[model samples]
Target chain A: MLALRLSRVAHPAVQLRRLAVAAASAGTGFLLLCTFGYALGEPEHSGAAVLRLSWCAVPLAATVYLALAVARTDPGTRPRPGLSALGLGPGRMMAVSAATTALACSLGSLGALLLFVQLRGGLRALPLDGGAARVLAAGRPLPVPATLTLLVLVPVVASVAVALSLRPRDPRRPAAGRGYGRFGAYGTAGARETFGAYGRFGARLRSGTGPQAPAAAEGARPASGAAGGRTAVAVPAGPAPGTATVSGPADALAPADGPADTDREDADGPADAEGLGSEADPHRPPAPRKPPAGLPWGVAVLAAGLAVEAYTSRAVTLSGPALSGTRTGSGPALPGGLDVGSVPVLVGWLLTTFGLALAGPGLTHLCGRLLQAVRPGPLRLLAGRALMEEAGRIGRPLGVVCAVLSGTFALLVLGRGPASALGPLTALGTLVVLGCTVGTLLTAAVEARQDRSATTAALVRIGAPGTTLRTAAGLRAAALLVLFGPLTLVVAYLSALPLAP
Target chain B: MVAPPDNDVLWARALHFTHNDGSPALSGVSLGVRQGEILAVGGPSGSGKTTLLRCLSGLVPAQRGEVWFNSTPVHTMGPLARERMRRDRFGWIDPVPALVPELNVWENTALPLMLRGTSRRRARTAAQEWLERLDVGELTRRRPHQLRQAERQRVCIARALAPAPTVLFADEPTAPLHRADRAHVLRTLTTAARSHGITVVLATHDAETAALADRTVPLLDGRCVRTVHLPPVQDTEGRAACSLSV
Candidate 1:
């Protein structure tokens, strides 16, 4: 009830975010219920119905994940500093967040139920519309138990996900500032140390006490107070053996041997990465190192997928000599079917998609490097850097979208017609899945943009012109399209080729 | 160091600011800065150093104060005018780098120039020069996440200096750097400001940083309690050294 009240009184932006989550849930729920209704209609093909319903779960799951992300970043829902003093601790705040998420999803599920029941006719009878009766067990009664089960699925999954993602870490640390529970930079060295790499994924996301800049690094020079009057300026250490002093200031900060002057690895790359020595080392100077070339794991997975597809494309064809006296009852095997079986083909497609997804971040990083390899202008530099920074955030979503497109393309090729062979219900299911996945990816991008807002604001304050930022954003989009657009087309075409008649 | 001239580039009188929560951030604070002069605002945390800097730079208008930038009344200017002034005449460096994580050191440094509609080639060239001047030229290809704290702060200083703003507002710009790097960056900043004739309003807690300034104003509880002037130090050649690397 408190969650619902808070939703009512929350900032418009927070409310809007929740509304989107609710809407997505409604769409997912509608799809799931439709699948369940179809199952009721076709009790004879109950196995197929179950499979279709399971497919519906994919989009529903994506929606839940997005909803959880939104909740984590919602400013109105975040616990403020001093709230714990009022007896609302981190533990209580987390519960509030989870409850709020559950309420939003439950609302969406209810919307889906109402819409489904209305579209199918009324609650009085199972109203199958648009000749769905022909494909389903048309005259059969709708099973209440089955329908209720499907309706509750979204809320249950979403709430549990919210609970798991938002559980409190250490209660001792005060809930302080912005960027807590946020997906990008935690901003505080303390928070970064406590949460480690897991914080970036919205896991153990800690809110800050306020919008204060993070305190300086631990064990460094202690900050001089007002009483430390007129302290002498620190003298620059002599340059290492071979280095020459340029301008006094520049010479002072210059690393004698490059970025390796310090033993501290914490400041090296991303907080999560240990050694990316070749790429970021300032001492190496000129020649760009080659990107890691071995993709043996991807290759092995791709080969396995190809073998599966090939076997499935043709039936079990047995040689007469090999089966001479082996089977008396079942003599010779003529090519059994066009493909080994739909199940094996599906599994192959899944493996191929997973391999591609795994390879996405590395490929994106390479694309970033390529952008700056030439005579990079300001736009190219900005775009390239952004791609490198956000490769992890956006890569998986891009991969998922690519996989869906490729799978749809292959299926279309196998059918060899503009008319979808999967039929209307199946087509609708696929659409929901693809659409929700893309939406989830877009939400991630939004979160990333939010993470960069402070930097943007700082730039603006310093008199950075607006066009520079806009151009940078445009360049990023363009570069991503240029790189991924072709890859998607090629993967779709190749995957579809094997099944072509 | 050159003696401060009589003419003031920026002057603020009787400034007052109250937060939305009713906490006073600045209370009747007043000061003046000469062109090419480096003025330091030294205080403890919450002593209103940052608030004073923001008010004088036209980032936040004080509810009760008169701010003049070379005879133009800054406090009375509209939002667009203030923004235009910031874009064209002023540069700011925060305590933290606050660099755009997606941008490399050069691109981040050149951002203000690019935003001002300078050609891509020109902006990048200017950015590269500043990066070299700050000794971070080799890391031009590196993004913020790829840099150490000191390297990142150097890039921030380069970005602020590249545009050659009339006045620069730097709030504890050396907070993140190690002791050695801190002196170097401060020297670079003071040298650039002097060479370029850019007025500097620096806010810091470090006495070393303030000692390099032409004058230091101590703020306490959002009010200026006192001002101190330091005698310029002379190098072996008998030239007055205004730099922090004494």
Candidate 2:
């Protein structure tokens, strides 16, 4: 009841996101119902009915993913200080988020039932447009038990996933030590203390205290203040080993290190980072960009996936009747299925997706490095550094989006043929996949921005022109577009090459 | 149409500001700083020192007041124009350090210079130099997460100083540092301003910090109650002599 009350008073933007989740749920529920209709209509062909039902898994997964994203971002469910006094702590909030998700999904399922019943002419006595009975298998009786079970599947799966993902962690124990949550962020805790806390999909951090900056900057220096003004300035340290005296106000105005003595890192090269290799020198120059580990695995998986797809396409025997020849084509991979079985092509696409998710952070890190490559001005350096910093958090979702786009592109390209065809179910399934991937990406981006609100406020405080920050954001977006656009196109072409007519 | 003084780099007159919630922040505050002068606005919290700084620096427009930077009337400028003015001519430091987590010390320090279109190489050289001055040059490659509170504040100081803005507004700049670190950071800030010929308007409740400034405007409940002028610190070197005026 509290959850429902909170939902009513939520910010409009939060309400919009919830509505989207419901819409996604409704779409998935409708797809499942359609599968049921097909099953009832073709009772003799249980094998084909089961295959069609199995294919609904994609939309179901998409809806669950969307629900989880929405739950993660819901501010009303975010744990707050006084909430614990009212038996509404992190654990309670987790439950609330899950319950809210279940509620939305349940509402969607009910809507889907109404729409399905109306479309199938089951509610003929009601005043509504009750048409499309033949297409929906209306004459065949839809079983109550089976329909209820199928309808409940989305809410149950989605709510459970939401609860598990938002489960509170023990304050004392580090996340990475217990077990790596999804995205392997916690798995890398032994590597860097800060990685897991800041990873985009790692954990739901407490609001306002997302991640610590660990500001303990102790360095060797002469005592300077009121006592040793001139004496302190004289020991110009290794940074300038150049004797730019810090005497009176006049001498300090000149650069400590003249142009000739600039550090090697200033140039567009990794020469300064050659020997650093993760060692904490305190005084050594900065290291080169250290992208999150998983690039190799991602590349290998992607290669294997594409290899399987290409091989299967070139030398396959169509044991099942060609989908186009006999039945309404199915299978999430080949939406308008062209004689391909579910297992082989699906495996290839799954591998490709997993590989891309694994490799996303590294590619994003590289893009950041590229932004700072040539004599970058402040905007480029800021955008590049920020991109590199957030690659872990944003990369995986970005990769998933890229994978979905590639698949959709391949499907559309393949559909431009005489043999390949897209039925309404296939299009609906495609819509769910696209919407969920894009929604997840957007949610991750919002999380990243919230995590850095302090930094943004500080930047504004230091007289940084508003346009500079805006331009930096633009630069980061452009950099990502440049890197991912061509990669997606190439991947799409290669995946489609195998099934092209 | 009352006008600002010709020699004052930053001037605010009859400044009044009320919070969005209708709580009064500043009421009829007025002050000015000469070129190369380090003027401290000394007040307890909620005394309108920060609000006065915000108005004078063109960060926020006062509800009813006049602000002038040199000859330009800042009160009439649009948000964009005020932003441009602040970027080109002013620097600010918050009580707590707030360096960009993603940027290394040098990159963070060089932000303002770069924002002004300075090349990365030149900006870096200047940033490293200022960081060296603040005794954090070795840590230029380190990100904000690696630095101590004081170190990050030092970097923030470096960033403010890198551009050598016409007016530097520091609101309790050394509040984050330890007692020992505060004096050192304050001296560094003042010395850098004097050397660069930068005008500074600092807000602090600490007498020690105010002593470093050439003059002090003490505020209470959004109004200046008294003005305290200190003898030239350069002439006295480490010794401070106060002369009070009401």
Candidate 3:
């Protein structure tokens, strides 16, 4: 199974691209850290500092690449480039994701062990006492055992747990409606019926009333009358089946049956009719057309959010002070040594903040596009429907993942002593992330439902049928499932990652 | 042969229809189709035969009077209910191939069944049987675009019959065939529909084809003026031969 999954991942061109990008980023970071070490006057522990910087580059590269991959992946269709295309059941996909995460954690732990070994050598070279050597050695053993255990067990346990516990049910089977019980008001068949009714009414209003007539009259009349009263000659017939012929004067007289009574009412009616015919036919005027509908709210919201994030990230540059520290930046300042001027810090902050802000609107736009592809409609409502439908499909799994990861990270960070003071702050940040996700999903749902209802009502007035309405609903539902599922997963993972807090 | 008595209540009153450009396509057309009878409507190109069929099916609106489908005012019914009525009761065949191109012949045939929520396997089995009956079972796996004109027509016919609709409105169903194929098609349609007690309302310009019907009504400029009835031919048994007319 491991080989099969890995092979699937290998097939994507994205994997190679990711590896290349990670290598480049780490190489650049290593070079910069080496420059800084040399400029700092080659301290006794300079080699250790260089090793620590190099070790840190690995996770930085991995995190950056993963963020880019997740952000760029379109949620509504086939997996993005570089993702395994093994046709793994949803269950298998979940397992694969878990395995990937565990692998990353193990790699990070190994890098940390290398950093500890280098730091220990540097400490011994600094002429520290025998006690310090013993402490450094003891600390060196600590990270090694942890790193070894993590490398072996993390992926295995995560893969097995995910495969067993979160295996996706067959999509063809009916899914249990989230947040609603079996007989709940929201997801019952009756709701479908109501929506169906609204959709049918809308389609009828759109088709209009001008075209339908008995086949006999439509086929027979043109050849027999008017247009210089030409003799009704039959056209060369094709060979399919069932043919008939029609006569001319009969068609002219058919519509004007009450002309006799009208003639009696006005002595000049016949002459008037003759004069009218000579003056150009008036029976064929065109009908007026309807106006187009306006844009949907969901689309508007998404656009606005994207604009805000773009503006804000560029506007605020965190610099100029260290908030009463020992110096400008000695010792682990700001909880995680995250220098504001550092490219990684700036980039990580920008992505995390901007991505969170854009999440709702992005989801809406994605959903809308998916719906439009399946069934043509206004973009705004399509987006709204997409957002709602997707949220429902992915909400539970995402919530569970967020809760578990945040809890685990909190436990690990708290166990690091002195960092325990920041535990509550991290918990608060996790809450904020979860709250944003839930809020975005709920907003999308409400907007989509509203748009569908409005469109259906409009179609009914114009004379559309139930089938059209049902089709629209189905389109909305499918769009939602496609656009929001992966997005929710990404959000959950991001929310659980260790931040400055 | 004696003429069948005319039923005034069954006749549809004259009505006018306008297009989107302030021009009228159909002007005051009137006609009637009785039970167990075939009504033929023939005209030149752009004579509004297709429009007339749309009006009959409640797909298009009429400017005047009521359209009675088994005595129900079709125009007054809600769009949803009207659509349901159309799907359940009327089988419409358009001149253009109307099958969804993505679906194969068997899938297209079983579409109505699937729409009605039948299990896919059962619906497909039924579709297979229907295709065999139409002598097109060999082409069941092919998509509509992959089939020849005649094969496509057969698949369409199979789709129409799959639902066993009350009335089948065919618009120039034979317009794409050759001479020999046309006669065979006409014979097959008439024979098959007769066996199923289906009323066929066909629009065509061929008098020879009209002669095959039990009764032929002529439509001139969107109006039905006269009707012709043909006697049932005697069979070898000579026991008042059965005629499939309506």
How does candidate 2 score on lDDT?
Answer: 0.76
In model 2 chain A, which range of ten residues has the least summed lDDT?
A215-224
Q: lDDT, candidate 2, residue A421?
A: 72
Q: Write the per-residue lDDT of candidate 1 for residues B114-172, one digit (tens) a residue.
A: 77778878999999999998888887866575566678888888998898999999999
Cα lDDT for residue A362, candidate 2: 84
Two-way TM-score contest, 1 vs 2, winner: 2
Indicate the docking level reached by candidate 3: incorrect
Better of 2 and 3 by TM-score: 2
Candidate 2: lDDT of A156? Answer: 98
Model 3: residues with Cα > 4 Å off, grouped in runs = A1-483, A490-500, B1-10, B117-122, B176-186, B205-216, B225-246
- Each model's TM-score for chain A is 0.65, 0.73, 0.28
Q: Give a tens-digit lDDT track for model 1, residues A337-407.
A: 22223456667777777766666666666777787667676667666766766676666667677777777
TM-score of 3: 0.39
lDDT by residue (tens digit), candidate 2, A77-117:
99886898889989999999999999999998999999999
Candidate 3 per-residue lDDT, tens place, B121-212, comes to: 77788888778887788778655544555667777777777767677777877777777767876777777777887777787778777777
Work out the TM-score per prediction. Answer: 0.66, 0.78, 0.39
In model 2, pairs of residues that clash are A200-A393, A213-B145, A215-B147, A215-B148, A216-B147, A216-B148, A217-B147, A217-B148
TM-score, predicted candidate 2 vs. hidden true structure? 0.78
- The DockQ of each candidate is 0.24, 0.25, 0.02
